[model samples]
Structure formats: C-alpha cells, structure tokens
Target: MSGYDIVKTRETLIMALKQDDEKAWAVFYELYAPVIINFARKRGCPKELAEDVLQETTMVLMRYLKNFQYDRKKGRFKSLLFKITESKVIDAFRRAGKISRLRNSELFSKATSEDHARIITERENIWDNEWKTMILRESLQEAKKRVNSRVFKCFEEVYLKEKSVEEVAEQLKVSPNLLAQNKFRVMKIIVDTAKKMIHNLEKS
Candidate 1:
C-alpha cells in the first residue's frame, strides 16, 4: 500500500469513467467485480447466479453512471452500488421461486409476508462490515510499510500476536516503555490512515 493515494485514485477513476475511458473502466471492474460477486455469494446466491447478478449490476452502473450524481451527504458511491445489488439479489430470488411465497415455521402454518426490510438491513450490515474490514486491512498494511521495521515488529508482537508487553519487550531486547510507545505510534498511524481512506471513499 506504500505510495497509494486513494483520493487521487478515485478521482482519476471517476474522471475516466465520465469520459468513457476503456482502461479506467477495466481497472474499475478489476477492483470491484470480485467484491460485488463475493457479496452476492455471501447472501446465499449460487456461484453462477452470483456472477449473473454481478454482470447485471455492472451493466446497470454503466448505463446510468453518466447521469449519476455524487453527493457524500446523501450517500457514498459504494452504497449506491449495494442498493443496486440488493435489487438484483431480490430479482434473482424471485426468479428462482424463493420469494414466490413465504411460509411460517415448517410442518404447517399459514403463509407470511417476506420480511424485505429485515433482509435489506442484513445485507447493509454485511456490506458495512466488509467495507470497514477492507479499509482497516489496507490501512494496516500501509502503516506497516511506513513505520520503522523494528518498531512495527515490536508493535506486531505486542498487539497482533497478543504477547504480554513485558514478554515482547524482553524478547526484542527493548524496554517495555519503549515497546508501548511503539505500539501507540503504529496504532495511531493505522487509525489515521484508515480514517483518511474512508473519507476519500465517501467524498462526492
């Protein structure tokens, strides 16, 4: 993640898309196609059906992106993507007869309405969790690259490996106080980087 510039990356991609730049479109697909496909798979869609949903989702975005407005206060671009994906997932379920009728607990009760609101909430939760996890992971990686190698190793030993502060400090031949300071410094870098990435992603 070294040298990564998320804000510049997003702006370039968006500008390329606005201009119908083929290379930018390809890069966009490479970055997001797998994420959307995995999201569908996590929602219980079969592999083939998930791929179909992804294709449909991409087509929809392509068709409408020219007219799409970017408004961070209203929502993020990714949220718009998830909304489209949700609809496609629902359409897939309907086509497969999964939503033809909702039934109560097995062995005999009257039909019930599908809880679409609950479904949407669940999917949104999934999306939010995944998105945050991705941002944090990338941030940590970038922080690792930017920090002093020894200090990062000490932080990793203490925080990531769950070692006692005294144990790791002794092992690394550094004072416990110094190790603690390194951990704090590295953790701050990771948190700050993640915040910046999230802000860039949310920018209109």
Candidate 2:
C-alpha cells in the first residue's frame, strides 16, 4: 500500500478491473478506504455508519465496475471517491431516517446550535487533518524507503520538523545550498509518488 517501486497506473487499474484481479482490488482499497471513511465521518455519520459507507462504496465499485466507466475528464479519482462517499453517506442517512423517528432528535438538532457548531466544525477539521496526514504520511514513508537515508534525514529536519535550512545544514554537516536541493529532491519524490497512487485510486 505504501511503496515507491510501483509502475501500475490508471491504465493498469482499468485492465485489472476488467479482469477482476485481486491485486487490483487491494490497490483500489488501499487508495480510497481512508478517504471514504473520513469523508463519511466528516459528514456527521457515526463511526459505524462511516465504516458501513466505506464498505458499501467499495462494493458499489466492485459490483458496478462496468456501470461507470473510468474517465479522467470526469475528474481525478479523489473526486470520484468523494462522490462515492457522499452517495453512500446520504443513502445511510435516508435509511436511518426511515427506521428512526429521531431524524429530528434533539441531539441531532443540537449539532446545528451555535454552542455545538464549534464541536461539529472541530470534528470536521480533525477529520480533514487526519485525511491529509494519512496521505502525507504514506507518501513520506514510501519516499523515505526509496531515497537515500541522508537526503530523507535532511527532509525530515527541514519539512517534517520545520527546521530552517541553516539549521538542517548545520545538523547534517551539509551546505545550505545542498540542503535546499535535497528539499526539492524529496518534494519531487513524494509528489510524483502520491500523484500516481491517488490518480489511479477509486478506479475499480
């Protein structure tokens, strides 16, 4: 799920989906599971509902693989995952409303109150932060393994710990100029890696 040697891209996903490959299924799950879960939870779903949404969305992709063809023109796979999460979350809400008269529950209403609005806002912010962190952490971990340890150490000091280039140069006994170069080097690694992973996600 988090590696840098991968060559599989969007075309690979389409081929895998058409053939129903297990590796393709795993790749698809790795890319979108956290996104769907976080998206559902951010939309006020309970934890169980968030998980259910993730599962349902995955099944929808697997079962209806032929129903919706992959198209970059439709948008990136991240957007497609959000669409899937939104649809599943709404379906859950509608089903819950049908079963529970508490669609209008006081506790649910309180979620919109000024006093509780802060809570809802904070929850959404936390979820967004977590989602971004998940992607960055995965990217960092994969990038770390692929590149030189010394270069990654410079990156950790400068970007991960917010150290100044001067500080990193002093700590690593490297020239500031070299530190700056390493920063770009690490950035390129992560950006390229994540783009590949994220672009092909949600395909199946």
Candidate 3:
C-alpha cells in the first residue's frame, strides 16, 4: 500500500478488537499512540507524563473498547479516543499536583460558561492540530516512497529546511526553476494523499 492500508473498516476493527485479537490491538496502538502522546505534550505535559498518558490511555481503550458501540451519528472513533486520552492526561496532572495549580487559577475557579467553552475549544484545536500534523507526516512519507529520491531530497532542503534556494540549486546542480517545479509537484501529491487519509479517518 502506498499510504496507510485502509483494509479494516471501523466496524470490522471493532469486532476484531472485541474478540481480543492481538493484531487488532497492535494496529490500534500503532495508529493512535502518537496522537495521544502529542496531544498530552501539547497540553503542557512533561515527557514522562505524556508517556504515562499513552500507557494509561492504551489500557483504558483495551478495557473499554470491547464493549464500545460504534455509532457514527453520535461521534467518530477519534472523538471517543480523544475523550479517553484527555481524561488520562487530566488524571496524570492531578497525580503530579499540576491540576492543583490549574485549579487555583481564576479561570478555573471562577470561570463562566463562556470561559469553559473557550477552554474546550482550545483543547479541541490542540487535538486537531496534532491530528493534522500526523496526517501530513504520514502523507509525506507516502509521497517520498513514490517520488524520485534525489528530487524529494531537494524538495526537503528547499521547502522544509528552508535553505537558500540559490544555494541548494547550485549544490544540487539543478535549476531553481526545476526546484520550484519539484516543490509544487511533490506538495500536490502530499496534499492529495492527506485528503484521502483524512476522509478515511473520519468515515472508517
């Protein structure tokens, strides 16, 4: 498969998960662990705490996923996973006494309904940012696999590393115009691939 193999539908995966299938659990971890870790880190968790959240969230998923009722009308799988991961992060902070500091904040102690809504929106933004980041990274990896290796390297240098385009063009002995074309072409592939992944993620 060029990108993530979308072989398992959400329903099929859930059924396998409910059966205690080891492979299904492994797939679940590989797909979601990074999102959980990044979500925690973005929420101000330390490295250790973020890792703890990953472990705790994994356990929680294993315990509860077997009985999960998948209903797209209610929410997507990511939303359910986000709620569990967010809960684990809060528990980690509570244990580390960080929640106490947050609790003492005026925003926490004297927040209005609007204030609470803002907090929820901010967290949702963080989650979406991390999710999209992961999608882009995976999409880029798939693009790399399909693109000419040397051209892709040049694209990375000029586009991602933000090196002087003139310098990179001279070193690579390619025209700046050629580099520009490569950038545009490779970016199109990445964006297209990411869109497919996002569609699957939301609908699977």
Predicted model with the maximum TM-score: 3
Question: 1 or 2: which has the higher lDDT?
Answer: 1
The TM-score, computed over Cα atoms with residue i paired to residue i, of candidate 2 is 0.68
**TM agreement with the true structure for every prediction:** 0.74, 0.68, 0.82
The runs of at least 3 residues in candidate 3 whose Cα sits more than 4 Å from the true structure, single-residue gaps closed, are 1-3, 6-24, 104-107
Q: In lDDT terms, which candidate is top? A: 3
Range of the 10 consecutive residues with the lowest summed lDDT in candidate 2: 1-10
Which of candidates 1 and 3 reaches a greater TM-score? 3
lDDT at 159, model 2: 90
Across 1-204, the per-residue lDDT of candidate 1 in tens digits comes to 122353446464555666787776675565566667778889889999999898998888888778866555777677777888878887887787766553333522532345556666888998777667666766788788889899999989988999999899889999988998999999998888877766666554
Measured on C-alpha atoms, candidate 3 has an lDDT of: 0.80
- For model 2 the local lDDT of residue 141 reads 78
lDDT of 2 at 154: 88
lDDT of each: 0.75, 0.70, 0.80
- The reply for model 1, stretches above 4 Å from the true place, is 1-4, 8-13, 20-35, 71-74, 94-97, 101-114
lDDT of 2 by residue, 21-82 (tens): 77767765665577677777777789999899989988777666666565667765555555
Worst 10 residues of 3 by lDDT: 1-10
Positional deviation of 142 in candidate 1, in angstroms?
1.7
Error of 1 at 181 (Å): 2.0
Better of 1 and 2 by TM-score: 1
The best-first sequence of candidates by TM-score reads 3, 1, 2
